[model samples]
Target: MSLPTWELIRAAGLTSYFLLFVSVSSGLLFSIKAAKPKTNQLLQVAHQSAGWFSLLFGLFHGLLLYIDTYKPYSLVEIFIPFTTKDEPLLNGLGTISLFIMVLLFISGDLMKKVGAKVWKKIHRLALPMVILISTHGIMLGTDSSNGWAIVLYASSLAIILSLLIVKLLLIKAKTKKVISA
Candidate 1:
């Protein structure tokens, strides 16, 4: 039995993006100390779970493209940046985002060995990963012009950007407090 590769690719990509949103939101909440201690623990778990699933779904999304009868992608084309004939730049961004996601996942897992500072530095790549994936979807996705997809892209970008700004403000405030002491 053969599955519908194109539909699966779209579904997986959308699902991955949604999970990434959840993960980022949860991570921001956790980092900002917005929840109570008990709830914070739950948020941490949610963040980790969502991140793992996001990566999984993202990999599924990319792999499905390899098997797509309409537009089959070679492993090299899919994994390497700017190697595809179709939409090279946008697809390259997606490919780079995928590598960043994988790096984030691995660095997170090896946080202890990598040290907190290094892990945090690598975690910062989440911002660019979101941007790349959003651009890839908005520009290259087949459903990008649809109302629901448009809403999803815009709203997700808004929410994530808002939270990021809040996180930055909180960091600045904390720094000021430390300096004033």
Candidate 2:
């Protein structure tokens, strides 16, 4: 069963985005491991690996689009945010998300060079990157009208939003406790 080039592009992009989600999930798992100090070092490694996979698959997706005869993407369109002639806003989100992911990639090394607080502050961009990519896929993807794609987007959003909300609440509570004491 041979698939068309367009289909391959969709598959590559969707799979890459999924890896990005997995990377984010693994990062959360690593963070929560503080509650269970016995957690394996593998968790952190998995997070790093997933990020690498996401980058690889994302490059694959971009390359496929660049080579597509139907509507070829220039290198600038591929790398620069909001520079694409086609689907400027939609594809722009993907570019912005890519920038964020790259920042996250180097954040571990930066954690030592910069203080942990600064590094962590930069890392928080992951949340916005997730939302941006999901928006990009939904708005620009061929599967935008597909029920499964919508569900995937919704479910991913729910998980990430919930986690962010919980973290925000915990931070607020901690701040309040400190102020009162």
Candidate 3:
């Protein structure tokens, strides 16, 4: 059976959110000094790949809305944050997240030109991007109340939060070791 247009939009939005989770989690591993070199490389690849996928899927979801007979969105609203008259705040959060993703993607290559420290700071936006994306989904997604969607969102949030805690602990331990040494 053929799927409805809204169903396609829902699937793309959910997939994009899932990809965003993968991208952010993989990016966090790069911050751990103790992470194995080989493992870090793999994580970098995953982060890059997932970031691209998430952006693409997000774009697809927004583009699908252009043809949505129920509620059409203009390009300005879809691409620009805070411009959508309908659910402006929620859509703005998502638009901001997309811009963050684009920056991170470009900064990966620009690291050489911009210097590693600058690039790293830019990439750190991933955490905030996650917040923006999650809030956008929760506030705007129609399928967000579904049992599966709730579980997915909760699981992703728990995992990312745990990873953040781990990164913080790792940083603290390294700091203490340095001071004691």
Candidate 4:
């Protein structure tokens, strides 16, 4: 039996979210010097691949909404923020987050051409992107109430936040050391 469109949409969304979590985690590991050189190389590959997959799945999730029989979304509603009558605010958050993710992905690929300084500035947006994406999913996702979904969201948040804290502390320590030197 064929899976329903709504189920497909939900699956795509969840898969995209998980891929995004992987990409961010890999990036954080590199930033915090948590991996050995050889392992870091593998992480770099995973980070880039996961990022592309996340964007593709995210786009697919949005597109699937168009094909949904119940409360179908228009192209405008899918791409444009706050254009829909139903749950405009929550959906708009998702649309905005997705756009930010796209920007991050494109800029990441062009990091060398853009220069490390500029690329790092753009990369900082990842934190806010994660926040917005998580909020959008937890607030709007149909499966969010399920036990597995709840665990996924909670654990993802906890791990990401913990890594971010470590990154910040390491940066502060380095800055202090440079000043003392």
lDDT for each residue of candidate 2 in 79-132, tens digit (9 for 90 to 100): 887898888888888878877877887887677888889888988888878888
Q: Write the per-residue lDDT of candidate 3 for residues 90-131, one digit (tens) a residue.
A: 988988887887898788878789899999899788888888
* Cα RMSD, each candidate: 1.1, 2.5, 2.0, 1.4
Q: Write the per-residue lDDT of candidate 1 for residues 1-181, one digit (tens) a residue.
A: 7778899999999999999999998999899998899999999999999999998999999988898988899999999999999999999998898899999989988999999999999999998889899999889999999999999988988998898899999999999999999
TM-score of structure candidate 1: 0.96
Q: Between candidates 2 and 4, which one is better according to lDDT?
A: 4
Cα lDDT of all candidates, in order? 0.92, 0.81, 0.86, 0.90
In candidate 2, how many Å is residue 39 off?
3.6
Error of 1 at 167 (Å): 1.5
- Where model 4 places Cα greater than 4 Å from the true spot, the runs are 1-3
lDDT, candidate 4, 1-181, per-residue tens: 5448898898999999999999999889877877889999988888889988998999999998998977789999999999988999889988887898888877877988998898888888888988988988999999999999999999998999999899999999999999999
Worst 10 residues of 1 by lDDT: 1-10
Span of ten consecutive residues with least summed lDDT in model 4: 1-10
* Model 1 CA lDDT for position 109: 84
TM-score, every prediction: 0.96, 0.85, 0.91, 0.95
Model 2 clashing residue pairs (backbone) = none
User: Candidate 3 local accuracy as lDDT?
Assistant: 0.86
Name the lDDT value of residue 45 in candidate 2.
76
